[model samples]
Target: MARPNSSPKASISPQKKNSSSPREADFDIQQELSRLQEVIYESFHIPVSRWTIIDEDKVLEQLEFIGTKIPEAIRKALQVLEQKQEILANAEAYAQRIIQQAQEEAAEILDESGIIQQAQHEANQIRQQVQSECEAIQAQTMAEIEQQRQMANGEVEQIYRKSVSEAQQIQEGADEYADAVLTRLEQELGEMLGVVRNGRQQLYNHSAQRQTNNSGKQLSEG
Candidate 1:
């Protein structure tokens, strides 16, 4: 047997039943308007700075829909904003760090400069001291050399005088020896002359005696 048209036993689809509900239809329309208002506020900071849940059930439905299917451009815009904030923060921190490092390096350079200046001063003092000592040694050596030369000159003068005196004495002794030899030779010549004269006188006397004896013999014989 076919069911009557007026029978209440006929079943409807779940989708159709939901569409027919007045409460559900009103909730869907109101949710769409709330979501539109939310978008406007986010874009322009309009209506107020504080967030308000004007239509709770409606806003909840729209938020759920956005979570599942948001437009690509909106998502991209939000990501760019977040990236820009992070970049600014990093730039600030890096600038502060660079400034601190520069300050430290400057301090170190100043300290090193002071140390170099001190070393230069000390080195200059030492050089001056060494120069003074060298000059003093040179002067002392020159003085000592002069003294030695003076002493040597005095000794040479004394030796020269002594040699002159000794030479004069030796010359006088040689002259006296020459005079003594001449006197002895003159005495020897006088003795030799006397002996020759005596020999001539003897020869004459013998001749005279021979002649007298010959004359006497001749007379007697006659």
Candidate 2:
């Protein structure tokens, strides 16, 4: 003989039967709520602000599903809600902490930016001061070098002029000495010429007298 059709309850899976049990009804409520909170936390936050953007429709869907499952659960949601004030207080404290931390971080970043700008400004001032000092030193060095060069040139010119004057004086003295020696030699040569002329005239006179005497003697004897 053919078997009769079984009831739907008899066809239910063991997993389905366990899910309706008192241990973990359908799913863990805390776990689901945690997932929801995680979803909200993962939302996009605005920069420099604690504002977050969430998906309204998706969040509502998850909440509605969680609410539907609450009645099926054996007062688990009631137990969770029984600590509402404590949960809200903890949430408020957590939000305040996050806001305070964000504000402190923003202030730190602003302070760092200010410090960097201040450092740059001081660096520029130091650079300008160093450049000015270097320029002044260079100008002073150039002036000192120019003054030394002028002094050296003046000394060299003075030495050259003194040497030229000394040389001229020596040349004039040598010319005067040479003229005096030449005058003395001319006088000595003229005196020797006069002595030689006088000796020749005396010899000529003596020879004439001797010849005349000889002629007279010859006549007297004849």
Candidate 3:
């Protein structure tokens, strides 16, 4: 037997649904772009994207990490600045000390230079005085030496003249004494010769008288 004819719509739901306009998908693109970077970061560790919607507790933890690191970086920068200030202060003090030392040394050099100049001037004055005195004494000494030489020359000439006169007188006296002795010897020799001649004449006269008497006696005998 054939079944009674059935409608195609019998298995479908019996309630009628109203259809006017389909609802459109509402999306915030700016918000999605802002969370894109966070989504990439979370995907590295958690394997979840912010586009998939994250939990409130995870976002709070990321904000706390950034806050703590900022204060620590600021503290380190302040410490470096303080150290540089101390180094600059020390350099300034050293420069001042060097300048003071140079000024004091310059003053001392000027004082010593003045003292040396004064001493040189005094030495020049004393040297001039001594030179004048020496010249005067030299002149006096030359005059005394000349006077003594003249007196000695005069005494020597007088002594030479007296010695020559005494020698001449002695020579004359010797010649006169020799002449007187020769005269006395010649007179004594003449007197002795005259006495011998008279004796011989007397003997001759006696012999002649004796011969004459003999001749007379012979004539008488004849």
Candidate 4:
């Protein structure tokens, strides 16, 4: 059988037509997700704390743009990520500045024991970690640095107390040694005095005996 001259026209999908958007894919989960992230970034963060500070109105307005025409929204999301990177870079610079300041202060505390030097070394290590994981670092940065500072201070206190105790023990031991030596010297001097007294008594007794013998002989001669 012969088909009709007018064939059924191919129906085009409206969804397919829009899929070729220059910026946003028609149903891109990634684009939607990025838009959501941008919205959040535009909504909440602290400036002084070295993080984002987003506006609520802007957050809501941008969120409304999701699932619809999202080309502009995705662009903004990319911008937000870049801004985050910039903020992170600024934070790293600030951290380095603080480290330099701390190093200068730590120099005064470091001595022959090098206890504070160890603390500074650990601080530098922390700074390195921050640099390595900058994208992931957050509020915990302050806490970590503070904890290290407290630990350093505690170590210094412990070293000081230990040093004082050892010094006192040394002084006490020296005093005891001196006392023992003096006691021995006194005993030896007493023994020498006794020997001198015995020798004097023997000499006196001999002289008296000799005088008596001489007197007796003279009497016999008379």
Which number leads on TM-score? 4
Better of 1 and 2 by TM-score: 2
27-130: candidate 2 lDDT, tens digit per residue: 55555565566556556665655466777776787788777765544234223323333333343344344434534543443342333343334334433543
The C-alpha stretches of model 1 lying farther than 4 A from their native spots are 1-159, 218-222
Model 3, span 1-222: residue lDDT tens: 112222332332232222443211222222222343353333323233223334445555544543444344333333332343333334334433433443343344334333334333433443343344334534543453354335434443333323334334433432342233223323422332233234334444665666777777888877
Clashes of each: 0, 0, 0, 2
C-alpha lDDT of all candidate models, in order: 0.40, 0.46, 0.37, 0.47
Which should have the higher TM-score, number 2 or number 4?
4
TM-score of model 3 (CA atoms): 0.28
How many Å off is the CA of 157 in candidate 3? 99
Q: Scored by Cα lDDT, where does model 4 land? A: 0.47
Q: Candidate 3: which stretches are off by over 4 Å?
A: 1-40, 44-50, 113-222
Estimate, for each residue in 78-190, the C-alpha lDDT of model 1 and write its tens digit.
33323433333343344344434533543443343333343334334433543454355345534533543354344433333233343344335333433433343234323
Report how far residue 152 has shifted in candidate 2, in Å: 16
Q: Which RMSD values do the candidates have, in order? A: 61.7, 53.8, 69.2, 30.0
Query: Best by lDDT, which number?
Result: 4
